[model samples]
Target: MKKTIVLVTLFIMPIVVYLFFASGITNFGKLAMLTHDVSEIDFADSNVALADKITVLGFLGSDVSNKKGNAFNLNQKIYKRFGQFKDFQFVMVMPKGTEQSVDDLKAQLGQLSDVSKWNFVFGEEDQIKGLFNSLGTNLSLDANLGTPYVFIIDKERILRGRDDDEDEGVKYGFDTSSVADLNNKMEDDIKIILAEYRMALKKNTAQREK
Candidate 1:
């Protein structure tokens, strides 16, 4: 009786494990690009460009202090993980006059992690609107010209996100205020996009070797 029970337990365990993982597979092999050729020309007073890098883009608006919590949440949850990866960057688009506000935010975030990849770019109101409009997302900037949401942009200057997100169907951005969104959905999408690029790089290298 003991041996039979042991055999049955072993037989059922693998099936249970497989089903658990199968149920959790939400993302497709690659995250679909929702917006193409997002403008990169509006960034000012900075050397950062969105052309050939994976960027987590955000807008802090004029009242930087109000968004401090959002920034901390993002830095702790997302930036700390992928910030230092090659060609990965965090770009916060701020209005031109608020450079000091950006500096203060940077100083605080610096205590938490090495924020060398955190690039703050200044832009005029019109320029900022032009850039934001190019994203084609349903999201809008707030009264101070900021939103609590941030988006993932790929190397080709395209916005990458889920087309069949269970809640929104077309998830254009992740809310920094929600840890669950960052952990469960955003992180998985990030991993998928990174893997896609890495695979392409490997294939190119193999072709070169041949």
Candidate 2:
């Protein structure tokens, strides 16, 4: 009777463990690490606080004359989903004096939601390029034609890449590619990162309580 019970328990435990993972009960993956740190940006004309914001950053300069790109619509969707978080922002880094163009672009896109959360910051060419380099992205100010890659930055100024820390999808260098399934996949990463931040906060709070 004892031998039969032990065999049954062993068989059931493996199946239970497999089902737990298969049912998405556990996410063993870690959140994406910061590829690089960003510096204090010299805003063109806004006083928006840089700290404590989850920013989706993009570039628009003489090289990137137009504001329309793959990131714009994706950002709108993200804002609709997560803008109520208050600290979330979509930052468009453009050249000084192109604020009008950005506004026009926003209007063109129908301004679906989170208009206040969309920050259009402008700076000189050199300042914008330097900021991009500091973030460890392979963006260029000299390229006449290139795709503006979007970056997800956390409150602590670390660049959050695709998925979690160990995933190969993380961007390490200059990448002009955009995700084909931009909305759903990137949104999932953003949620995971947000959850990670919240978990850290809870852990810190618990420590303080003790």
Candidate 3:
């Protein structure tokens, strides 16, 4: 009986640990959704060595029309805070027609603050659909789901988290009403992620000095 109990405990221990850390499991589906390599994106042209840059990729829905101000505000905050780290870049990808033109979006972003360090990429409806679908983000442009969904991608091209649980590969409908809250939540989450990156950089720098 003692030996049998020990075997059972050993078998269940890993399951318990995995459940505890399940949320940190990397989203492989989201990682595959990236259509263009961050290093090759046009905005990265001048900075080809983005491997050293901490990159954030945000995806907004088609319904985010006329909400340019909100988007700009969030991006501005992230840019200002993350810019403190060298080689850090933030890229906002949105579907076309939901907001204004790429230039208009850039202008709005610029208005928030001097956002010259960031890049804005505009995707047509179909292209955006493809991008999201590849990442398992289940909202469709035809369904009238507005923008506001966001995803964070690291320099290694791993998607940290998605706004909707369904987008994270779980079974469920996308939450339309949660976009605004997600916008707010993401702003805070990005800061934490940047801090983690900074710490990792510091550790590497210390190791080199030694």
**Model 2 clashing residue pairs (backbone):** 138-174
Instruction: Point out where model 3 deviates above 4 Å.
Output: 1-52, 60-65, 94-100, 123-126, 138-146, 162-184
Tens-digit per-residue lDDT, 103-185, candidate 3: 66667667667776666565565655554554444444345423444455566654455334433543212222455543444
**Which parts of model 1 are misplaced by more than 4 Å?**
1-27
lDDT of 2 at 165: 29
TM-scores for all predictions: 0.86, 0.71, 0.55
Per-residue lDDT of 79 in model 2: 62
lDDT of 1 at 46: 59
Per residue, candidate 1 scores C-alpha lDDT tens digits across 1-210 of 999989878998878744433333444667888999899954576578998899999998999999999999999998897786799999999988888889999999999999999999988888888999999999999888899999999999999998999899999999988999998888777777776777689899999999
The CA lDDT of each predicted structure is: 0.87, 0.62, 0.51
Task: Give lDDT for model 3.
Answer: 0.51
Error of 3 at 207 (Å): 2.3
Question: Tens digits of per-residue lDDT for model 2 on 115-165?
Answer: 777777878767777777877654454452224566778888888764332
Instruction: Give the Cα-based TM-score of candidate 1 against the true structure.
Output: 0.86
Give lDDT for model 2. Answer: 0.62
The stretch of ten residues in a row with the least summed lDDT in candidate 3 is 24-33
**How much does candidate 2 score in TM-score?**
0.71
